[model samples]
Target chain A: MTTKIIYLDHAASTPLDPAVKKEMDAIKTYANPSALHQLGLEAKEILNNSRSKIAEILNCKPEEIIFTSGGTESINLAIKGIAQNKGHIITSKIEHPAVLETCKFLEKNGFSVTYLDVDKDGLVNPKDIEKAITKETILISIMYANNEIGTIQPVKEIAKIAKKHNIPFHTDACQAGFLDLNINADLITLNGSKIYGPKGIGILYKKKSIQLEPLMHGGGQEFHLRSGTENLTNIVGFAKALELAQKEDNNKIIKLRDYFIEKVQKEIPRTFINGHKKERLPNNANISFLDVEGESILLYLDHKGILVSTGSACSSEKLEISHVLDAIGIKHDAAHGSIRFSLGKSTTKEELDYVVKELKQIIQSLRMLSPIHLNKEEIRK
Target chain B: MKIIGYKQDKAWLYSNKVKEHFFNPKNIFKSDQELEDYKNNADGIGQVGSPACGDVMEMFIKVKDGKIKECRWRTFGCASAIASTSILSEMVIGKTLAEAKKITPKDIVKALGGLPARKIHCSILGDQALRKAIENYEGKK
Candidate 1:
């Protein structure tokens, strides 16, 4: 018999909700939204309705939303669109690679970016954002919540700082869609896949007052910002997914996530939780098991029909440590032992209990195999 | 419950042989008692990589006359590193030190069907650990 699979990697990607799928399947307009014919007008109407639905959920004007490929593209557009040929940008080190790499590319293109340091809990100090701002500062880009560690940044505070400086603030809220959506920023990046919607569709919420250089040049679509044939099906599904996500009462998920974190730390010896306990996302639990490698634990868990994600160097192609963990001041050796368990709507308490049981055994077995012995004092750190 | 094989999405991540070794690693210390026993009775011990770097392999061997009679190993790493050391432990058994020393990473990769191109370095680690284990044994003599 096949073992029942337990999925705890929702932060990586969530399964498409059935309602969202139904909405996508109901789409009948095949013509491009940009076409001038009658069918195209119908598709355009559907697109506008979907955009309006999303705007209603986000509390923004329908015209301010620009659909892109996904969160990466949305972020690229938000950062690159606002960037001039040479200017200063401020972002935190714990930001996702999309933001980090885009800043790096800008650095190569004559822009100077200050990668602000985060605290031990992976929090970006708003004062640091203010301190880093200069006369030449163009924009401030920071993630709403980190993908790996799940530490939520102080977006409102940073937005206040950016407002005082008269700078555009961008927040990648891809991982925060399930949580609160009252983010006050000049530009916000969100994607469909993370919210149980179809992939390859994302949204960039730009205020009516802001200006951006278009990343794509085509038929003058997306208010002359992003020009392409609109993905109507994905847009419909995304809107449905966002609507459902906003209505969801996340107390159950938050309880389950807390239970998992508490259970794992209690049952597994020498295990410590990464990121801030109270400030993290309700679905995320990043734990580090000392003296054992993350990829080995992940493989063992996968063998037992439990899917999770790891940030260990062995898990990646280049064998580099996780930048989020590094920014949080976790040692290089300990950084390789982190596992992120991001809960979803379908996750149950029994599933989390099973995961903890299996994880205890796996960590014990891997510890027996390990040559390094970490003491309790070391684990306390 | 037994997961029969690699899932369809991850079937190409590693070869079937590598999966076999990973799921059923040979001569691994499954308990603290076995590890303590090996610590006292093993003829030679070798370790490579470091915990700081995300992989550490501990290899132990027992010799009979001039040939390696037994080998046991463990690793703190990914599936490929564990599988490489697991298969290497089997390869070194029943061979003289010189013969085992000649077993290159290519041979281990060949024996295990093949590893991902990026994981070739993981196989090399086991080879180096084996050579070091032999050296430790010879040095003791």
Candidate 2:
């Protein structure tokens, strides 16, 4: 019998789909796309076809999608590239560190970046973005969906404002693409690993009109924008994964997500949901239990073979609370107790049920031992 | 749960004493009133760290006739850190200023039975905050 482990942390990274794995395996037996030979031509054909497939899913032209290393590189290239040309940028405080840190580096280099705050639900007002825009503002880089809180932003409205002001709009859609292909962005970043694709593959969608100062300089690959020989296998797998994720019924995923949320909320008291209650990603459910640390809860669940995330997996090593949590104005005590449960196409009700059961036990036990809770009780008495 | 760090490992895993403090801290106390009422007011207060750094504490001292009459604290940190602060406050109360100055982070940890190695910083933070508060009190007088 196979040991059952409920894997609910898809937002961190998903296992490669069997179909994507097969596609990757097939690509391994190929010549480099850059070589000058029939095999190379065949490989080039496969690569271009994959790119076109991904573009089709994203509702963008094939030529606009430039493959890169992953989400981090894509975000860095998009932010730094635009910030170098234009000295000012506007972004939200809820953005992933990939975008936030890149902005910080740009700021150190004399670029002015306005980090707009988000509402309690982690939604950035497009009005705020518009108001923050200055004559020197060249880019507005916001995330389509937050990784930790799963709050979706008003990218379409923000994009419209950017277009009206003749500014480039870049959104890191690595989390959003797992739900849909709503490419309401001038420049969009997507990562393969976030959607059951092979790791080390990502795409940057750039409209033809926007001019960017290139981050990489060398062999004029990736239309002279990104200079590197592509990891063909991973790119092929990434495209396949995107294609599959896009084709699936998003409503089904949303229903499952809702069911899980409903169950958890009903069973667990003092549980507060993070992010927008309705305008969130279909597969994300972030919640914080009162009087408990998320790290401790995660450790307990991990021992019971129920894997979930306390915060962004990328920044888990940092002791500070998540920037996403802070942006939504969760109190420090509650922020430290936040947990993100992101689902995937493979997730099921049975798995969610098991996770809910395990979480209730762990949270109750942890709260009992919490000094904060005890202190509150003492005062109550 | 698997303990990840050397500090937590050294302080939590092998020692039953550290676990006792972490799970069941003694001297947990809270007071919302300003420290102004006491004749020997704990005016010079100090707070270190914030929610962002995962630990926050406020330490206050009341002095009478050149001796420490009372010490009180409030903290928002991990169990070991909070417990250590609470116990440290209780330990230093009624002691002379000179004797209280000798109290180190180790003393706070020892008072809590023993804090986990990872949690030694809690004691350190509490000690620093308390010492700084004392220094501020001294500066005023």
lDDT of 2 at A49: 94
Candidate 2's displacement at residue B90, Å, is 19
Relative to the unseen true structure, what is the C-alpha lDDT of residue B112 in candidate 1, on a scale of 0 to 100? 91
lDDT of each: 0.87, 0.76
Clashes of 1: 0
Look at candidate 2 and tell me the lDDT of residue B51: 46
Give lDDT tens digits, candidate 1, residues A227-288.
98888899999999989988998888999999889899889878888999889988999999
Instruction: Kindly list the per-residue Cα lDDT of model 2 for residues B1-141, writing each as its tens digit.
Output: 221211222122324544555444444332223333432456566667654455666777878877777776656555565567767777878887778878998887776666545557767778777777788888997
How do the residues B67-112 of candidate 1 rate in per-residue lDDT, one tens digit apiece?
9999988787777888989999988889999999899999999989
**For model 1 chain A, where is the 10-residue window of minimal lDDT?**
A372-381
Quote model 1's iRMS: 4.7
User: How would you class the docking of model 1?
Assistant: acceptable
Q: What would the per-residue lDDT of candidate 2 be over residues A43-111, giving only the tens digit for each residue?
A: 888889998998788787888888899999999888887776538989889888899899998888888
